[model samples]
Target: MLEMLDNPQLVKIHFETHDDLVLVWANGAPPLVAEFVQVKGAEADKLWSVADLCLRKKQAVGSSIFEKSLDRDQHEETACFRIVTLRPVVSALTPLTYKRGNEARAIDCDEMVALKADLDGRMPNVVSKRGNGTGYWLDNCQWDARHDEVAVKTHNRMRLFEIMQAAGSLLLLEHIDILLDELRKLVKTAGDAKWKPDKAKKILTRKAFLTMWDACLAKLKDDAAQPSGGKLIEKMSNASLTGTVVAMAVDMRLDYARSVRTSRYMQPDEASQLQGRVKSEVQNLSAKRAAGTLDLDGPAFHALCVDRMDAINASLPADQGDRSAFLKGCMYDIADRCLLRFDRTGL
Candidate 1:
């Protein structure tokens, strides 16, 4: 399952648990913790319906901003958060007549902040809870005080992994686009197409991408190092590195298009479409691998991309959008083809 996550744009993994997980938005932002209504046994179903209705109402009524604090930046910050409680369906032993109040409870915004602080202190190396723990697996945490030798070194390695994960999330596409702009200007002013290829090739090399990925990967790896990051880092290898590089290049193109001055100048839908297609195909490949179809980059992949491109071109409307979008299409084709070939042929 871990190996399957080759490239993720936005992924939310659901876990079965009663422990509340806090979501802290961009920095200095008040956290939001989803509150579940307690529903015992069969009453859970009724509460789930009620909670759904409440969420719909909240959406309809709209939210009003509430000022939380004015920080040292002189920015008058306002935070508007709503607490939602849902009684989700569990196992047969945890039946449907379950009332939300009996089965589950949600922590408020304040409680979430306190929890974050507590978790940060107690599980200094741990990031967030991925899932539940059981008997022999009770000490399932990534960071353990018990294992002396493996604990310390592996913990640091986990930190690096978290750094990479965080780096991936940081949305450095904007910076890449900015740099691309400078590169374009330099090329245009020089009036030398010959020079441009050499310059661009230098920018888009494995070494360059690796350097940047290392920096971001380090940051992400650190943030979730101890338990979560350790698990993730253990999954990384040459194939993972290649996927990361491909994803970064695609990300650069997407970011560039999003920053175009006019909406027509860059169409995000194109990139989004391509992203969706690639993600689906990758997932399918992962499924095939699981089913004993170990040849990931076989003929199946080429057919997938060919079908994908046909769909993309079919959906295109007559408009000259950003070059990056077109470039991305080609990049996706080449990257996926190469990835599959590499997967099949090996390094």
Candidate 2:
């Protein structure tokens, strides 16, 4: 749940059990969000229903808020609440029924509507025997904590893309959109169902989108490093580095990234995950160039790659690990991967 809220825009955040989670609006602009919220399961089963549990808590909290309001000296802050459940509310045709005190009634209408009514005090207060206060309720809500990790992650991935866009990383956002659009189409096409919302989430969630963005930033740092900041670095244009140089630079980096990914230290599954992360950058690089956004000339590209290498070399000790030095060596090797070195004679 917190992971979903780890957005750049969220100015304040907190978490708790029973309370579950708490968030306050930041900048008062973004309309909050649908945080994915993975639900856990058990043979013993869940402790509460979306409507029942929250309906009760809302009354209790509302009563408290009401009591506090009477004091006038005390102030109460409004909070939103959400209840996520593994099971979907069955259809009214199924005649879902529940006990409200000694009476049981058919859930003859939309369950959520019924729930909202209970929460808002529009219906008979079934929260507790006390039924005091106007009844507590949320400003907004959802029942997202689901058993499906893919669905959960997929929901979060889209939110993460929103975060990226808000952060002004347009190139990364467009790339993720392209990939997700294709993946969603492929999933629905393969399922052969008319179309369900859940199918799309699974296919796109498995790949780490943020990790792809991190790789892009690393390349940007590489781009910024071009000419190693000798005044040239301050104004180096990606246009300074041509397309051919970038393709070659990506090739060398991928090989290094792959070797690290598949190293014996990594478990088979872990290695695959690492490879997946690097490969995403390769794809994004291709997309960006195809879009004509990045096309630095030879000198600029060389400087970018070299600066990234220099940063690594400066940070670590010269002999910390043979493996570390070797990685740095790979960076240097690509310093001229696409450019031919010529003597002053110009041969």
* Number of the top-ranking candidate, with lDDT as the measure: 2
Candidate 2 segments whose C-alpha is farther than 4 A from its true place: 1-9, 26-75, 91-141, 145-147, 170-347
lDDT of 2 by residue, 138-244 (tens): 21223344556578656756665545445543323223444455444644443443225443333222124345446655664454334333222212223354365
Predictions in order: lDDT: 0.33, 0.38
Model 2, residue 66: distance off in Å is: 18
Query: Candidate 1 versus the native: TM-score?
Result: 0.23
Model 2's TM-score against the true structure: 0.33
Error of 2 at 302 (Å): 19
Put down candidate 1 lDDT per residue, 1-347, tens digits, no spaces: 11112223112211112211111122233432222112122323342321232232244331211010001112122211222233332221121232323322222334333433443343234212322211111111111012243554444334433342444432222323333344345324433333345534222323443454456445433432222222222222223433554445445434433333123333334444645555565556556765666554434554454455555555656574324354344434334334333234332
